[model samples]
Target: MKIDIIKKYNDVRTATIDFCSHLQIEDFSIQVVQFASPAKWHLAHTTWFFETFILKNYVKDYKEFDADFNFLFNSYYNSFGDRILQTNRGNMSRPSIDNVFAYRRYVDAKMQDFLERITDEEVIDLVILGLNHEQQHQELLITDVKYMLGHNPIFPEYHKDFNLIKDQNTITNTVKIQSGIYQIGHQADGFCYDNELGVHKVYVDDFEVNNHLVTNGDYLEFMESGAYSDFNLWLDEGWSWVNKNDIKAPMYWHQVDGEWHNYTLAGLQKVDNDAILSHINFFEANAFAAWKGMRLPTEFEWEIASKELNWGERWEWTNSAYLPYPNFETANGAVGEYNGKFMSNKMVLRGASVATSKNHSRATYRNFFNPTERWQFTGIRLAK
Candidate 1:
């Protein structure tokens, strides 16, 4: 059992390192948008997480790769110490691409050595948690890199062949869930984050949720119909955002010769109407849903429906704040800082995005972001 667990943990860590190997040195430092991170920073930050949380806490005689890394890569953990200012992460070009890879190797060697010698279940659990956390960042790596590269005049492809999903017709089967006492949030789990725990019951009124996500074609219709101009179709806050930002179309979308084309990391391609509509925030999603006489699902409704469905197509925005469960308590020490601090003032996202790892996603995995933020892989699932 010990060998199997350690091997599994090491495999995940190695895969993360290997994923970084695909990018060029130049690609590692470009933060074209403020919302995205440079790929090099992501590489260092994930390593910093393991070193700070698992290695420093548990590994006897463990030495940090760089003393300054604790300050440079620490992200939002006030308990861990002051984090590098988020906006300044792009300015960190000193840790050259080569150094970042070296940092990863140092962390990797220590992690593997610890895995080989350690047999404590508590330690194993922490390793598994770290591996999972890295996987989450791995997905972010793809999205962040894409966001950065897509902003360049010469849009570069992240992968040579842009064929993760094939061109097959998606089933438009809308599933109607009966209104009743439906339990939402995390239930059975080998491992779940703190926010997903305390599986609580939530009563959902009878609602219809689309089997698949909204398509670009559906979104385009809203655009062509002047949906953005109609204040009635938008929430008060959403209308304010639209008017303030003059958002006429989804981000990355541009009209050419009266036709819509979207700029992707793969360059400007004709909008794939069948592909799930992505890069829209909660406000836009809610506005689009309202335009169609549907509504965004509440977090409970989303969880209840998502628990029974395939969720990797897109991360569905929920009409719920990322608050604690009825009787939630923080974990001891710094780990407690994980989910509690960001609970208020953020909207919850359910399911996982297309770029997300299949293993990393769960029905209860609650992703949160500000409502106006659209840099992440966000989309909408219609509920009525």
Candidate 2:
């Protein structure tokens, strides 16, 4: 058990570095937008998480790689220290990509030493948390890389030979769900974010959810139907976002010489109409559902209906607003900020995406984002 736990920890930590193998150092510094952090920042901040939370908390002789890194790499842990402004993450070039890599090596060596000597169950628990936290950032790092390269004036690919031809062969139809009371939220036998706890019953109405995610070909019809320009098809805020941004297609998508093309990690390729529609935000997903005379499934409906269906390729936006479950309690101190702080004014998404690492999600896992943020591998599945 001890050796396997260390091995599991090593594999996850190694994967973070592997994610950078495709990128040039220059590629590591672009934030692209405020929500996305520089690749360098992600690399250092994740390492900082280990150094600050585990090593510093437990290792008496540990020394920080750099004293100022606590400020530069701190990500929203206001209780611990000040954080660099999100808007300026891209602007700081001094930490140089090389320095971040060195910092990763430093923390990784210390982590190995600590793990070799660790016996406390509490330390092991925190190490597991760090591993899961790194897993979340692994997905974010990949998605952010796509945004960075895809938005370049001449669209670039993240990998030269790793083009993804997403397999999407499921029958595109809805499965009828009978009305019933259903149990929702994690049952706590396994690891889950705190927000997924407080499992409880909720009555769900009869509804039908798409057997498969909305595909590019399926979404193309909505675009052809002038969905973007139609205000009546959107929520009031959604309409404003559409007009304000002039959003005409999913992110990383372009109409080249009149045919549709999308940027992929493998590089720019012709839009595979059969591929599941991804890189869309909650607002866009909702608007598309409205255009089709359907509505998104509530999170409860999705959890109930997904057992017999295929998912996990794309994070499907749900109609449900993000909020606490029955008997929810925020963990005290820094851990408290993890899920509770951002519960309101956001919408929930269900399922894991191709970018999601294996074993990172559960049936009860809830992913949330603002209506307008779309950098993650997001897609649409309709319900009514």
lDDT of 1 at 223: 86
Residue 68 of model 1, lDDT score = 94
Q: How do the residues 136-252 of candidate 1 rate in per-residue lDDT, one tens digit apiece?
A: 888888888777767776666766664332232266677778989966656784988888887677777888887777888888899889899999888898899999999998877
Error of 1 at 247 (Å): 1.2
**Candidate 2's residue-wise lDDT over 1-384, tens digit each?**
579678988899888888798788789889888988889988988899999999888999889899999888888887787878988889889788898889988998998888899999877878888888999999999888888888887877777765543657478667998888888888757578888888899898778888988889998998999999999999999989999998999887888899998888888889998988888998899989988889999998988887866888889899999999989999887878778999889999999988887679888989999999988889888888
Best by TM-score: 2
lDDT of each: 0.80, 0.87
**Regions of candidate 2 where Cα sits further than 4 Å from its true position:** none
Number of clashes found in candidate 1: 0
Candidate 1 has what TM-score? 0.94
